[model samples]
Target chain A: MSIQISDPMLPELYKVTKIQENTHDTFTLEMVPKNKTKIFSFLPGQFNMIYLFGVGEVPISISGDPSSTDFLVHTIRAVGTVTDAMSKIKEGQTVGIRGPFGSHWPIEKAMGKDVLLIAGGIGLAPLRPVVYYILAHRSKYRKVVLLYGTRSPDDIIYEEEYQNWQENFDITVETTVDNTDSEWQGHVGIVSALISKKDFSPTNMVAIICGPEIMMHFSVQELVRREVTWNDIYISMERNMKCAIGFCGHCQYGAKFICKDGPVFCYSSIQETLKRREI
Target chain B: MKMLKTILENHPSFQELEREHLKFVIDNAENIEFKAEELLFKEGEKADKLYIIQSGKIAIELFTPSRGSITIQTLGLNEIVGWSLTPPYQRSFDARCVEDSQAISIDGKALRIRCEEDSKFGYELLKNFTYTVVQRLQRTRIQLLDIYKIRT
Candidate 1:
């Protein structure tokens, strides 16, 4: 069952090591190579093609810490057929993992600058690794702030880890829930509102945003108002990815491919493509 | 009500108020404290006062039929807790203390009257409240978008 990762097309078999419910509908999955001791590694913003037996594969971001070599982790919200089926699978099941693909977040370039991480809903799954990397090597960066927004209080992911990220890692984590629950006592507004309330200077600040396309679009606008240039802001784009190898036209956005050219890209690079309402 | 000039100057919204109008607000306002779980106001009540939180948190809530009480927002220090503008001024949501909290309560009636007497001050206050209203409106719009859902 231990398979090699040299062939980027054929997925190496991996067995689900752990599974946990992240929210009412989303789940976090951990997998390790079924036969091989070496599981493929990934960068913060990269993803893998998760294949469900007899079903299909979907491009899911690698949500685990890059520094930790133990197992590969992914957070999946059961929306479509494949993901819904994957969500129903129990631990100790076999699945296919075809990558650690795509360009990574600009973690290295962000060194010595203030880092602002903005996530919306399940979008946090992709950005969680960036936070982890920053926490692991906190000395490399300046102030790190995470502004996360969700639909309602119940939709938050990694609720238990937020406290530790704040207290131990010293990252500013501000969360907002649009709707209310008795247990939720936080800001009730868009993440942009929280950005206004913050004092992060746009100078020498790099912002990494991942969320709904619309939310990401607006977050960039707000940051621009705060003097963050489009060049310094990066966003993770999601599209219909089939090959993830750039050969397939399924993931094209203008000249770039969402799977190969990005999943992570600077705002300035794709501003034109992003503006097209229907595309 | 003796006021700290720094307090007024520190908040972005209050900072925009002319000094005299700022002083007028401080003079008309009274500091009050509420214990945890205490209700400051309720939905459908006449908008009598607006509270600017000095410290602690206030839960802006609504009574949901399915979920009972749902807190829509938590107002903290330097944040205003009540919105009362123009006619038919009525509280749309419940306000409760999340923790032992201190805030300054500005009488809505007195504020309206002051605004009427001083047209310039009235315009300034209205302008400030407009920002608040628009901000809340944008937030509401995002909430309606359910930006977090797996699919739109």
Candidate 2:
């Protein structure tokens, strides 16, 4: 179902169907529209402004498979007052959702080219939808390489999914942890370290990165070192988004409003702004 | 010797070294392989060799009272491991093979003597090792930040 934007600012009521704890601080919320028959449709990388009754709202990425129209999914970390409250919300509770906003990962543009997905920490939430899209239409793309990094082995989200993607699909999935105990046998290093593995060609590749700003910066540098062009590289930027539209200056980075102009942007367009110390 | 020289030439760490300097280092190096689960060196052991990984993975680990053995880092194909070239050299962590691995192990003592005999070769080796050290340090710093952890 396509998104029905009756009012950009007003949120529609949605009933929480399930909540799955991904880690100590991260959880996935599955919700469906309370009064509408149509499912909430959104492109990969777009976000929804999830609101609790008395508490405020926060922008969270749409993390579910786009083809699955049964419910909308969001993977969020309980990092602030609003998100902390949202974490305690029970299944069957009602919440407000306003969007499907911001730019999306260029899945269509990436057709016939190698797709590189690099995600760090909870940054993987925004890129999960893109992974689902690529898996559904696997034949449309060339080599698909996913390099994910987390704080530790326990912090890794979608652990079984990574194994499935690696074993079942014709994709290269390399997961690294910043630190790990002896029980963890996987690579232990920064996410950027995995780039040198060179499982996919840099030529004719579309790279999508979403992570802590510093992590993204270094990952971009490594990709560029491997000859991936700036135009072919995309990044999802996070900011304090109050309004899902350009009217609010809260999410502005340089002249671009992250909520409207991006969340997903070609790295070539904002490399300069990204380098700025404060914006 | 020719094969070892070729491997060193191809490795990014030693690729830019002067031909004679490369040859000098390779002279003190020999091909070695370790099976999966083999311990290459142990913590506090006399650090005698530096391994230039040709293929496969090796974990640099530290043993803690609580965790037993926690991996500090994993070095893979074309990477360098071990760097106790100074006096009173001792392995700071245990290096164990995570998979069947091949590398060129350079005798640290021989290489140190070679460095003293030839300052140019010493400078070259120092430069390359310094680069590796810096890179590892930067990666360690990033890991220390726990960037993936949710910060409220």
Candidate 3:
């Protein structure tokens, strides 16, 4: 059942070992080869183009929490054919795997700085690794704050992880729903409102954001207004990714390939692409 | 009343509304309070009112039995909540009061009647509502693109 595309480097025979449904229409697949437990090491923000036999392939961010390197994980939402196939993939089914590729979170630079992590909807997948890395190296960063927003209480991904993050003493976590829900007991507003209410100084803060482009743009603007310099902010951009290598133009947004050149990038570097609505 | 005035003064849509038209719309609107987790309206229900948040949050939910319910969006204070004039003219979706909330709402039936009585104000209101829906639709399309990749 392995149909090789032109590229030989992209591995097509990885296997799924665990599956956890996160919410309606979304699931996280924990994968490894049925033949072995080991998988390739990846950067904190890298993604792999996952293939599901006849269903085709789509780019997915690695969602393995950094505190423990258990298995390669991807939190996927069933939006199109490829992702729909992904949702049905059960443990023991075979799925394709490609590069643990792309620029990673700058873990070294964030050391001793207050880290602000902002995510919208399912955009938290890309930031999950960064959270893991920070929590793993707990003493390195002074203060960690995670701000997340979703369309509703049901749409929030990683429910258990969210609770753990909320309870962690080393980190301050705030949640917001675009509209509130009966079970949503916290704030009910845009994530930007949470940023506004926090007393964190952006002078010593490094902000990383991923979500809808509009949300990222707005959150970045809010962070800037709070004195977070563009140099200190990082964001993950989403574009169609065909090749994890730069050869495919699908993931191009300006000069970068979100799969290869990024998936994670500094705000100071990608300003030009950020302004273009199409990209 | 002060909260209503301040919210209207601060809202972007009201910024350019003619003073007379603004006052007219405001005078026609009345505040309604809902108990926690109350159903404002259900999908396919008659479109009878348009709402603006005064306080608390409202969740616009879309439900499919197999997949369960997903919150499509949330509307908060100072945000407009429905497009009662839009096609289907019935509620295309469901809105639920997620918390004990207060909202300023105008009767759609009365507004439509008044709009027929005076097309000028109707035109302005409809123009604003259409623009807001278009902007939100564009944002939703992109957000869905980024977040959803269904395997075919």
Candidate 4:
């Protein structure tokens, strides 16, 4: 056996068991830890760097819940070189993984308040872990709503789980597509259109959202219109990340490092950063 | 066809085309109508054709989990839409009609075939598409640069 250096922050190579396509360029990779007994834990928004030997590695948000250490999962979009390499790997192929890193969703604080979760396109992957965490501990919160939007109905991710969330009485879910097809029968418009129609008390609710930078900024404005405090809204961000440890400046968002300060952060905490497109 | 000639003749991108060439292409164009909130094309839909806005607006948007649908850009009259004619013939983003609109469109595949048959038309269309993509790319780069997002 070849001896490998051990890093507390890095999870050992795990074999990818499956890859599920979400959109034309996005996919979900399911991998079980090489040492399954060594539990890897993370907050809902935390991410990892899955190292594919020879082809290199890329930072990917963990889409799996912290509650279960059985298998680590990632929902990734093939945007560049490393991601393209990641998409090519198949079942039985071993890939290196590091970290359940970054600030997690504020689950403890969201308790007892109505939670509004909004996701756009592949942005749902990062929010998936938090949704599972909320549902797993259902009694801790009041009403819940998951409002999502994608390019089209076909671009919606997590089909089975989306249905399951819809079935639960405590949680409500709605989806919108930017463009509709012949078979599509749902609402067709910008995701922001749905906000005006939602009947939720912004005063007693915390909103969690992830997707593109522009989308989050606009969503914040909408929630503010509803009287939701900036502090009550949290948004996850995506940036080019080489080191999950934050030593590298690749994932910098203004003064905050997305890898260190958060992959998830309350709008109040990073309002300034969020405003700047550079972050 | 006459309406198309007038519209294409006025468009900023097509203004440089020789009048004869403009009229020739315009003669083959067709007008299409879209109802308010109707999808023009989805994210992954095959881009079999390209469109030129005659009247009204089209919104290009991207979905995010934290944010619902984020409107990226709104193209109004005289704008060209769709950019999948090259090697990677896939739609990159979603396009929808923000209002009931009228547009002139040409079958992209058919145009490509025509371009193959007639090199001059191919050169003209490619030049126009390149100009359109470059202009849009500049705007997108500025948006992604996050300069406006910064409060200070």
Candidate 5:
């Protein structure tokens, strides 16, 4: 979605329509614009700044299907102040939302090429919309593969959807956990291990990764080792974003304001900055 | 024997070995398979063999008092499964077949003798195994970080 800059800083009122508990610490919130006719639209990878009254706001990626005009969805882990408050919000309550900000996954660029998505933990939240978009336009891509890794079996998000995607769609979904007991009958290892399990034309693929910085670091190393170029790899980066626009510099990484220049960045563009310590 | 040799040649762990060294490995190797849910080796048992997985899955697990067998890693096609190649060599974790699986198992005793007799061959194999060990170590460290945990 384009930046809604007419009132970029102002938050539109949206009401919590439903709240689904996804895991012990994570939850998915579905909100509809309080104004009956207002439409909330976002492209995959864009994030909305969710404002919970009296508690403050946090930037959360839009996790629902982009085609659905009814409500905005965000899958959030209750990590800090605002999100902890957000976790307690019940259905029918009101919250403020601004934007659909930042650049998005380059779905058009991946038209004829294979799309590889690597997500770790809740990092899958931002990439879910991309999967939805791909399933909606299945023929545009070739050999779509998603490699997701989380802490354990219980930590996996969208577990039911994984089954649906595997059974009904043309895409390939491979999941692994960092560790698991015998009760879990799936792969147990880092997400990077799944990269070699599937064959994709590295030179003819677009890889998008969103996860812990270190996990992304190793995954990129593995992809590059497999001959995928940095130019074709994209990563969604998170920083402490205070303002959704470029004006507030709280989320600056080197010379770029993450709020404006990214959330999603081509690895080649930020490779140097990404390697630097404490930017 | 020829098919097994071809499989060894392609395996990442043995791909770098010289022709003679490859022959030595092939001579010491034998085809082995395990049915689903079969135990390959348990922790504290003699680490007498190394397997180059040809098909299916093997889970490297640790038996804990409270949690039962916890799988730390899973090995599949073209992956190496055991590497306890030092003195007092004993399996550090339980290796169990997650499915019907096949592998080329090398007799560790014979392999060790060949390595002791030929320093060059020994170095080559050790180097390859070291690379695999290092990669596993890196992955283990990443897992230990619990990088997925929510940061406050």
Candidate 6:
């Protein structure tokens, strides 16, 4: 594999090409490299270091399709100082783009196998690319199911795309909201609740799970109970990713640097690491 | 009407019982039908029996003086509702028909008397109800999380 790791200390300039507001506090930004040489590629589960001119940087997942090389897409929720500023940045503005770092979901190994994508809240953004990839190569995978849970109907993102995906692809999309109004006439429960309701061959299924740490923990348990092996289950871990490269120690888990080693990992690889009480 | 054999083999609450024990309950069961907007039983009324939905929808509702009646859950085929036949023997929610529905109602008093006679069979029903209770509990807890609240 010819791997070209980018320089970590400095970030390249990327101009915001398009902007779309998702929710009251979340927005999606499409950026393209200002310098032709900085037009880098990334896998489904990798992340980018987004930097505002004066403020610091934060890691946001690449939420666009791999096959579509026009622009890099990221769905960001304004949570802290850096993200809050990035969310406010207008279209056509230039921002710093760094390495599309970390490992990705086993989309390759999942060929001819059933795929289950379980996400909670903002966790759905990172997994969006996987859905795009499977849809792009529909016949390569056997079945794809997306089980997503949010706080309520209003909190759901990509509502239009979900409708399109279900109608167009051979994919099953199930969603649950924690709270619902009378207007919301759908499943009201945790995302994990939908696991047993769906039909999939557990032995032949590869599950990619993301969300809050607690949600991921519970989802892994549910998948295991349904006979999905830990080896076939992958999860994306979120941490304080300061340097897109491994040098900054902020994103260390056990002996691995999340920036360099993974944002995606097989459950078996991190089982013991998650079990540790605290560091 | 759906057959007793189907209920014995597939009802969410009673399907796990041994055939002999399940047969005894099936003997006491009666199939009931309701039209949309009709009541199965009102909240606070005597909990006469437990129901295993055979078809259609039954809404478990709570009637508040202010909000009137609000549906808590709408249960359908093969799902069980009304476990009030257990200890309290008092209906907890007003179960009403949302869509024309059919269910197998097992007489609570007779079922309780039967349980007293057969402790092993009673234990099986207890286990089944526990599962339903836990499922409801977990769903409620998820709602309590109010997961969609935009964090600042």
Best by lDDT: 5
Tell me the TM-score of each prediction against the true structure.
0.90, 0.94, 0.65, 0.63, 0.96, 0.88
Per-residue lDDT of candidate 4, residues A116-175 (tens digit): 888877788888888999889999988888888776666777877777777874688877
The ten-residue window of minimal lDDT in model 6 chain B covers B142-151
The whole-model lDDT of each prediction reads 0.85, 0.88, 0.75, 0.75, 0.89, 0.82
lDDT of 1 by residue, A1-279 (tens): 012247789888888989999887899999888767764667899989999979999999999998776688999999999998998999899998888788889999899999999999899999999999998899999999999998887788898999998899889998987776546657777787678667777889999999898899779888987899999999999999999889989998888899888989999999988888777
lDDT of 5 by residue, A1-279 (tens): 364545878999999999999999999999998899887778899998999999898999999999997899999999998898888999999999998899999888998999999999999999999999999998889999999999999988998898788777877888899877638877889999878767899889999999999999999999998999999999999999989788889999998988889999999999999878887
Cα lDDT of model 1 overall? 0.85
What stretches of model 1 exceed 4 Å from their correct place? Answer: A1-5, A35-39, B1-3, B17-19, B30-32, B64-67
List per-model TM-scores for chain B: 0.87, 0.92, 0.81, 0.81, 0.94, 0.90
List the candidate 5 regions with Cα displacement exceeding 4 Å.
A1-5
User: Candidate 2's residue-wise lDDT over A209-258, tens digit each?
Assistant: 99999999989988988999999999999999998898979998898999
Model 6 Cα lDDT, one tens digit per residue, A150-250: 87777788888988788899788977776554545555567886786678999998999989877888888888888999999999998888885788799
Runs in model 6 deviating more than 4 A are A1-3, B1-16, B25-42, B49-79, B94-110, B147-152
For model 1, what is the alpha-carbon lDDT of residue A51?
A: 90
- Local accuracy of candidate 4 as per-residue lDDT tens digits, B1-152: 33776777776656777676666567657899999789888877788877887776787766567766656766765667884468566777788887788999867776677678878777887897787787566545534444212132
lDDT of 5 by residue, B1-152 (tens): 23898888888778888898888888988999899999999999998898888888999998889988889899887788876566677898999999899988989878888888999988988998988889888988988999988765
Q: How well does candidate 2 score on lDDT at residue B111?
A: 82
Name the best candidate (by DockQ): 5
Q: State which candidate has the highest TM-score.
A: 5
Cα RMSD to the true fold for all candidates: 3.5, 2.3, 8.6, 15.0, 1.8, 3.2
Q: In order, what DockQ does each candidate have?
A: 0.55, 0.75, 0.08, 0.02, 0.78, 0.39
Which stretches in model 3 have alpha-carbon errors above 4 Å?
Answer: A1-8, A35-37, A67-70, A181-183, A277-279, B1-152
lDDT of 2 by residue, B91-142 (tens): 8899999989998898888888878898887887788888888888988998
Candidate 1: CAPRI quality band? medium
